[model samples]
Structures are given as C-alpha cells and as structure tokens.
Target: MEHVAKTRDRITLTGVRVRAHHGVFDFEREAGQEFVIDVSVAVDLAAAASGDDLARTVHYGELAEAISAAVERDPVDLIETVAERVASVALAFPAVEEVEVTVHKPQAPITVPFTDVAVTIVRGRA
Candidate 1:
C-alpha cells in the first residue's frame, strides 16, 4: 500500500473560561480561579460541508463542554498536564485528525506583574 499525506481543515474554540483549582501552592488550591482554555482541531470537513449533517462533523458545543470538564474536574500542578489532557480528548473524536490545546493561567501567584501564564501542546496521529 502507498501512503498519501492529507490536508485537514481547522476548527477552533478560543477563550473558554472555567473555574478550577489547579496549582502547586496550597493557597491556590484553596482559592479557585478562572482558567482560560483554547482548542483547535484539524479534520476533513468536506463530508460535513456537503452533507450538512451534525454527525459528519465534530460538534463545537460538545467539544467545548468536554474541554471545560477536563479543566474543572481535574486538578493538576502544571498547565502542561491540562493541555495534554485536553488534546487527548479532542484527538479521541473520530473527526479530529489532530489537536492543539492551550491552557492559560491568568491569575497566577506571581510577585511581578504579568499578562498571563500558559502552556500549549499539539498532538496528532500519523
């Protein structure tokens, strides 16, 4: 058999806010904070576009809910872990060929002033 590279269309969900306790510090875990999540999935959309069926495409509403659950339900020390978990969930979808996840911690316990702290990860099947 021969192999062919496939090009995928992207579906993105940005700025998904959730309240969660995820941190190494005790104070952080005690006082939960709002987390921002962003997710992007790559998939073939031709079938969905032509068929105009919900089953043919990955549902953004469902995907967003799943991602929010991952962030809120589980507490981890690093945002990297959160990003990885989110990517795994996205990749599990049949329509998703690849996924990229970003977990943002805006209210971090930092002594200096900063905009945000985040971790981004990309995962896919070859």
Candidate 2:
C-alpha cells in the first residue's frame, strides 16, 4: 500500500485597497491618503477538508474587515506599522500558522515620481 502525504494549505487575500490617513506628513491625517493591503495566511486544512464547513476555513472577509478597522482606527507614521498590525491580526486566528502582510502606498508624496512605495512583513508562530 502507498501512503499519502499531508500538506498544509495557504489562504491569501490580495489587493485589499482602502483610503486612509497613514503617513508621516500632517496632511496624511488631515486630508487622508490611499493605501493598499495584501495578506497571505498559512493554515492547516485537514479538519476543514474533512468537515466541509466555513468555520473550519479562514474567513477572508473577516480578515479584511479587521485590517480595515485597524487602519481606520489609528493613524500611523509608517507603512511598516500598518503591515505589523495587519500581520498580528491575521495571526490571531487559531488555524493560522503563518501570515504575511504588505501595505502599498501609490500616492505617497515624494519629491521624485515613482510607481509606488510599500512595506511587507511576515509573522509566524513562535
């Protein structure tokens, strides 16, 4: 008989863009800015695979809401802070083993015109 190998599944939510006030400049808070978020979570899918239940899987909508809430609730000076907050929230889920969050700012007020600026962070169970 041949043995089957078990593998973990990863869930990802990408391009979750939200306009918020997150920047080092005062105008960022007063006028607000546009930001984008991307999140990836690694989870154990054995139970969800066998059970076929939504509860067994990570709810991306909830994750997006959480991220949005965090960003909107607090004003930060850097995208690094935003990334950290997003990763921390994603890792709060029991099923999530690892999380990666990226925050993108396309309209950053820079002296030189560029495509975009972003910050990425990865967090896992310790």
Candidate 3:
C-alpha cells in the first residue's frame, strides 16, 4: 500500500512591504515619501499542488506588482484607503478566498517622531 500526503489547501504571504508616497498632506504628495505595505491572502493551493499548474496558484510576483502599481498610481488622503485598495487587489485572484492588507507610513510628518504608523484591512469574497 502507498500513502500520499494531502496537499495544503491554503496560501499565505507576509511582510510584503514597499516604499511609496501616500498621504493627505501636500508635502507628502509632492515631496514623495516612503510607505510600507504588508499583505497576506488565503488561497486554495490544492489544484496547483495536484496538477503542478502555475495558474492554479496565486502568483506572488503579480500580486506584488499590482500592489506597487496601485501605490504609485495615485495619491490618497488616508492609509485606510491604501489598505482597502491592496486588499481589493488581492481578492481579485480567483484562488484567493480572503485577504489582509497593512499599510505603514514610517516617515509621517508628525509633530514628534514615532516608531511607525499603519493601517490594516481584511476582505473576502462573497
């Protein structure tokens, strides 16, 4: 008798941060600052594991590119919006069942220097 290992059914990514400019302040939008983003997606990887098909798995490269594009394409007033957009993009993949996005602004022009400022959002397919 032969035993076969069951393939994992979920996919997760973490610490996917990028630098960009996103803020409501005029200086932030004009001067261009650095913003970091972390994202994770719950996806079904069984198909890809069984069939060895790239299409069956969510491509991290593409996901990263999409996030980068979104961050660079426009300037928003809030990190909440950035988180929402990143989560939305992650959910666009058919294999992704749910997504979590966190946007960090480390260099926010606050009155005092802080460790970091960030926003996290989660979204799922209905």
Candidate 4:
C-alpha cells in the first residue's frame, strides 16, 4: 500500500486552560494547578473547504472539549503523559492525519522562579 502525505493545512487551538491535579508532590496535587494547552492537527481540507460540510472536517470546538476532558481526568506524574494523552485524543478523530500537542504547567512546584514548564509531542497516523 502507498502512503499519502498529510495536507499542509492545519487547524490549531491555543490557550485551552484547565485546572487539574497532576504532580509528584502531595501538596501540589492537593492544591491543584492550571494547565494551558495548544493543539494542532494536520488534515486534508479539500473536502471540507469545497463541500462546506461540517462532517468532512474535525470540529475545533469538539477538539477543545476533548482535550479539556482528557486533561481534567486522572492525575499523572508528568506533563509528558498529559501530552501523550492529548495526542491520542486528537488522533482519534478520523480526519486528523497528524497532531501536535503542547501541555503547559505554569504553576509547577519549582524552588527557583520560572515562567513555565511544558511538554510537546507530535504523532502521525501509520
């Protein structure tokens, strides 16, 4: 079987804010924290653009909701796990050929002052 390249067209959702309890320290998880996420999906836009049908493409609203739900679930020790979970969620959409997920934890428990901590992952269909 021949493999087709994914379309360059990308649909992105940024700054998806959610509060979840994910951390290694007991206090950290007990207090909970805010996580910001960004997601991008690559898919063929010809059908959706030409036909103007919602069924032909992945819905941004639905995608955001899915990401939010995924993050708000059970706690994990690392943002890497969250990123992987989000990538899996994005790949579940039939039209998504490739997905990039970024999970950010701004309020991480660091002794030194820092701006943010994040993990990014890219996944594609086989």
Candidate 5:
C-alpha cells in the first residue's frame, strides 16, 4: 500500500497543458505531444487566511508557471520522472509541506484505443 499525505490547506492547479517531448520511442521524442499536468500542494494557510497576505502563502500563478517550465524544460523517457520533478519544485516553497503531481499523456502511442495514460506521485520532505 502507498502512504497518503496528511490533509492540509491545498492549492490545486489542474489541466495545465504543455507540449513536450517525453517517451521511450524515437518518434515520441522527435514528435512532441501535449501533456496535461495536475498539481496539488499542501501548505499551511492559517497565516495567510488570518492576515490576508499573499506573501504568507504559495502563489498559484507563479507555481503553475514553475510546474509548466519543469514539464517543458527537459525531455525524459517517463512521466514518472516528470511527476517527481514537479513534486520537487512544489516542495521548494517554504510553506509547502507535501505535493501531489499527475502527468497526463493523452497522445500516447498504443495499438489499442485509449483515452489517456498518466502517472501520479506524492512527495514530502524527509
């Protein structure tokens, strides 16, 4: 069984679309495709809520751009790596305690028909 992170105030960015080259096949690497990324970051928002200060919380706009850049920055062979990379970025925020990332590959090359394929991972500080 996998461990689930404890509940906390979350900032979710879903359906963030980015085009990238990531796959095991040569064609997949050469011909990039669109990837939809979903990220949920767990952080302490009590200060921000009480103080009404943006500085006390994670900025969703900046975080979304950071996640997108991580996805489009390098060409990896697996979405699992991409998910980990996103999680790492999220965990860098001072207020973030845990992160969950989902990398969606809609144009995967498979013989049979499929809607999508993805990898979801959860990570936190050690």
Candidate 6:
C-alpha cells in the first residue's frame, strides 16, 4: 500500500535479471528460469536533493537488492503475486509513495513462440 504523499519524482530500475522458480508446472519449478524485472517508485526528492542527503531519498541500489531478494525468496505460480511482493518491498521504504512493478518471464513454457511474458502492477497506500 502507498503510505506516502503525492510526489512527481520517481526512481526507476529497469531490466533486472534474476534466476527464479515460479510457475504452475512442477517441471518449471525444478528447472527454474531467468526473470527480467522493472520497478518504478514515486517519492519526494526535494529534501534529499537540496540537502544532498541519501537518507531523504529512495536508495536505488538497496531497492534493487530488496526486489531481487523478494523475487528470489519465494516460489509462486503467477507473476502477479511476484509483482505484489515487489510492490510491497518498494513501499516499505519511508520515502516511497507509490510503486510500479513489472515481472518478465522470457522463457515461459508457452507452446507458441513468444518474445516474453510479463505482469505489471502499480500500488499506492490504501
């Protein structure tokens, strides 16, 4: 949930690659696959920018690690659930007001040829 005030400034992390086991099939869970992720978080950056303080703004490096850990920690059947988990992690940061998460499965077990399969979600304080 979004716990922060409305802000135009945002931090974005794109194309994070991770190996994870997330699928409906047992084979998929056993084999695992490479997942590409994208995350955008909205936050107020004026204080941090003006004061040159890291504490007042979202730390993207930590955010990336957190999202990666979130994806790696659990096994789920749907990317939607993965997106929610990432959103929760981003919003847990004090400066984050909103978050958008996209989970990409490049090697999904689809019968037909496809470039990628992904789920995107946006969350804010309730």
Best model per TM-score: 4
In model 4, pairs of residues that clash are: none
Candidate 5 lDDT by residue in tens digits, 1-126: 999657578999999999999999999899999999999998888899999999999999999999999999889999999999999999998889989999999999888999999999999889
Candidate 5's C-alpha lDDT? 0.92
Residue-level error in angstroms, candidate 3, position 77: 0.5
- Estimated TM-score per prediction? 0.94, 0.89, 0.84, 0.95, 0.93, 0.94
lDDT of 1 by residue, 8-122 (tens): 6989999999999999999888898999999999988989999998898899999999999888876888888889889988988999999989899999999999999998888
RMSD of each: 1.3, 3.6, 5.3, 1.3, 4.0, 3.3
The regions of model 1 sitting more than 4 angstroms off are 1-3
lDDT on C-alpha atoms for all candidate structures: 0.90, 0.85, 0.78, 0.94, 0.92, 0.92
lDDT of 4 by residue, 41-103 (tens): 998889999999889999999999999999999999999999999999999999999999999
lDDT by residue for model 3 (16-107), tens: 66666678888887887777878878766767879999998988889888888887767788889888888888888888887878888888
Model 6's TM-score against the true structure: 0.94
| TM-score of model 2 vs. true structure | 0.89
User: Lowest summed-lDDT stretch of 10 residues in model 6?
Assistant: 2-11
Q: Per-residue lDDT for 40 in model 3?
A: 76
lDDT of 6 by residue, 1-126 (tens): 979546889899999998999999999899999999999998888999999999999889999999999999779999899999999999999889889999999999999989998999999977
User: What's the lDDT for residue 26 in model 6?
Assistant: 99
Q: How many Å off is the CA of 76 in candidate 1?
A: 1.0
What's the alpha carbon RMSD for model 5? 4.0
Misplaced by over 4 Å in model 4 are 1-3
Clashing pairs in 5: none
- What does candidate 5 score on TM? 0.93
